[model samples]
Target: MARSLSKPARTSLLPWLGLAFVIILCDQLTKIAILRVFSYGESVSLTSFFNLVLVYNLGAAFSFLASAGGWQRWALTALGLGAALVIIYMLQRHGTQRLFCTALAFILGGALGNVIDRLAYGHVIDFLDFHLNAWHFPAFNLADSAITLGAILLIFDELRRVRHGSR
Candidate 1:
């Protein structure tokens, strides 16, 4: 059976929600700066292995459905917004769980950041570029970074929970 929290032990979701807000703010701010400073496809070399390039993704990660025309744009926006709602719900329920809430907050922030871009520009702005030799990875933004980090943390949290045999 799972242990229950007493009234005094219950935690609020406000803190985690604030963290999500911060993430979203940072993500959007950077995107705004990139949009204002860089033109489409413009790249500024930051290092031998990396460049700052402005790009827009109309589809999901890796531009999964980028060529599918305009329908995918609304579809992706709806999906992201829906995911954010669900994540908020999850966070409200598990606010006392630090790792879980952190992961959800990251996802919620990233999803909101991308959704905002999709709504405002019909695409997500990406600028970070990494390349080595002949290989070049796709450009991504801080929102994507937070989401990736959150996923890794989620996996680690699950592993830890499993090892502890806690339900």
Candidate 2:
């Protein structure tokens, strides 16, 4: 006969939560500074290939559904909040997975930042434009950056898991 083992200890998820909060804080603070300094549609050259611009995104990535009038505002806000809640739950469940948790943290922060923007200004504030020659990428902010990075990290983590034979 074998003795039964007790349950594993519950590890706190505060560190990951703190990282998300810090990302959100930085994203919002930068947006506030840009709002104070730049007028709408303002663009200032930051480098040969970059610019600091003020633009409002009433839609999602690449301005998807941006021309849908006022309805997208509420729709996007609800979507973002929903994503945040889901990411929080994922973080809670997989907090020990460092890369996965970190990615989720970033996504959570970015989603909340956009949600706050939607609530306060009815749109997302974007700056940091990049361009080359006649082509220009969409203007974006720190929150967008975080979300993009998170997505890339998620892909990398998935690849690593496959390589290591972990599901």
Candidate 3:
């Protein structure tokens, strides 16, 4: 007979899911504040390199496929939802691996956050902007930030794993 996960093993995934939920909450709340305070294309200079701007992305990171004439909305939404499911599965299997699960949780939260935007408004709302003189980075939101951070953490985790000869 095959053994199943014990109760403690199954419950180990909860903390990571809770972290993802908190990230989603924070991402959505900030997006709400930005929507209430800024009109489309409106920008407020907050520092030498940062500004609060209002923009909607109909595409993925850096507005890729944003001009695909609307198919991207549902496509990205489906993709995000798919990724979230995989992340949850991975979290359940590897919940005891701190760094790996943390990376997955962040990515899961950000992916769902953006997925919510796509489902609710047909686009992802982006407002955080950074620039240098004449060049500006693409505007993004808390969800995007979380995804980026998660990617970095994943890289670090892999490097550490490789260095330490642990799988």
Candidate 4:
């Protein structure tokens, strides 16, 4: 016999999706503003350790395989899209778990945000540079920030679950 899906499960997914959409909107809007305001490679110091800059990433995190002769563009885009699908499925299955679903929602937003950039410009737009006395971290944008936060939350959630002896 086939089991039926519940209405609550369907409704529960909406809030997570809405959160993802908000992240996507904020990511894109910030990118657009940066694109309009900064020329390529331009940097403006915002603090002792922060700057607003413009850069494009053609590959995954930390520019991994970024110089792989352009094939990484579509490959990374496909990877992001695939990850989004899996995250959504997980969100549907675990929607009642607030921390887990929130983490997935953030990741989903970030993935789609980067995916949008890849499709529109063939690269991801990155800014928000942080540095210290000539040593610089890689430049990244809001979407990257969201993804990182989500990953951290996922780890924390797992730790909490383990401590509580819950699966």
Candidate 5:
């Protein structure tokens, strides 16, 4: 019997894992650079609305539950690990879906990046800042940016899928 040629090859896991590693490297490297160059809470203006600053956030985005004493640390850490595991499961199941895969990769990279910080520093290092006269957004880092962008992409992808009736 002739061998069938229609079967596709299996997808490799290297690229996705590499993407996550790159995200973590960039996140940690930038944080280190900021920590070395600036004092905690010090800002060096790079533009009219942007600054390279150093901050250690002991809480989640916008400092949610920041004042809840020490328990927030373990709680957030567990949440991060749980989310990472879920993303990994989804990636394994649906990685061939490009949009979904990208979204998951970004989220995974970001979650691990911050998780590294929590384990090493007991806090997350945030440097990028945006502000206007009399108004300021909370400082954040590369991982946070990636995570937010990933979430937005996931939403957009879902919306597109819904519009196209592709599920």
Candidate 6:
């Protein structure tokens, strides 16, 4: 049987795409601002809990596989592309579902933001840092925030679906 598009699908997808585009704009603008303002590895403590630390990550979060003599760059680039494709597919298929569409928008924005970084600089730019006395958390940026937010939204969406009998 052929599937038909519905009005609800158009409404949800349009806003999802708009949100993703807005996210991309914000992520890129912040990265550019940080690049122009901060020297690499420079840190400006904003509070006892946070700082803006400029750093480039040649690998994934926490610098995973960063020391693999550079092979991981290509590997990770490929992985990101694959994930982007999967996400786009999900957006196309489930864009009528409000929560699902929101999750996909976040993922799409984040994936594209990092992809732009890898292509332009061969690494991802990270600036946000949270720390305490001698302890530190990994620095990240808008793109990372979106990806994490997307994952959380996905979980919330699932829970909501279950509760609402939409499962």
Per residue, candidate 2 scores C-alpha lDDT tens digits across 1-167 of: 99879643334679888998999999999999999999999999978899999999999998999999899999999999999889887887777889988999999889888889999999999998999976899999999999999999999999999999998
In the range 1-167, model 1's lDDT, one tens digit per residue, is 98876543346878988998999999999999998999999999988999999999988898899999899999999999899889888887778889988998998888898999999999999999999976889999999998998999899999999999986
Q: Could you tell me the TM-score of candidate 6?
A: 0.89
For each candidate, give its TM-score against the true structure. 0.93, 0.93, 0.94, 0.93, 0.91, 0.89
Residue 19: error of model 5 in Å? 1.1
Q: Give me candidate 5's TM-score against the actual structure.
A: 0.91
Q: How badly does each model clash, as a count of residue pairs?
A: 0, 0, 0, 0, 0, 0
What's the CA RMSD for each of the models?
Answer: 2.5, 2.5, 2.9, 3.0, 4.4, 3.1
Tens digit of per-residue lDDT, candidate 6, span 63-155: 998777888778888888898788777777777777888888898898888888888898999999999987999999998999999999999
- Please estimate how well model 3 matches the true structure, expressed as its whole-model Cα lDDT: 0.95
lDDT of 2: 0.91
> lDDT, candidate 4, residue 148?
98
Taken over the whole model, the C-alpha lDDT of each candidate is 0.90, 0.91, 0.95, 0.94, 0.86, 0.86
RMSD of 3: 2.9
C-alpha lDDT of residue 80 in model 1: 92
Please write out the lDDT profile of model 4 over residues 1-167, one tens digit for every residue. 98886654533789999999999999999999999999999999999999999999988899998899999999888899999999998888778889989999999999999999999999999998999989999999999999999999999999999999988
Q: Provide the global lDDT of candidate 1 against the true structure.
A: 0.90
Candidate maximizing lDDT: 3
Q: After superposition, how far is residue 66 of candidate 1 from its true place, in Å?
A: 0.5
* Whole-model lDDT, model 6: 0.86
Which ranges of candidate 1 are over 4 A from the true structure? 1-10
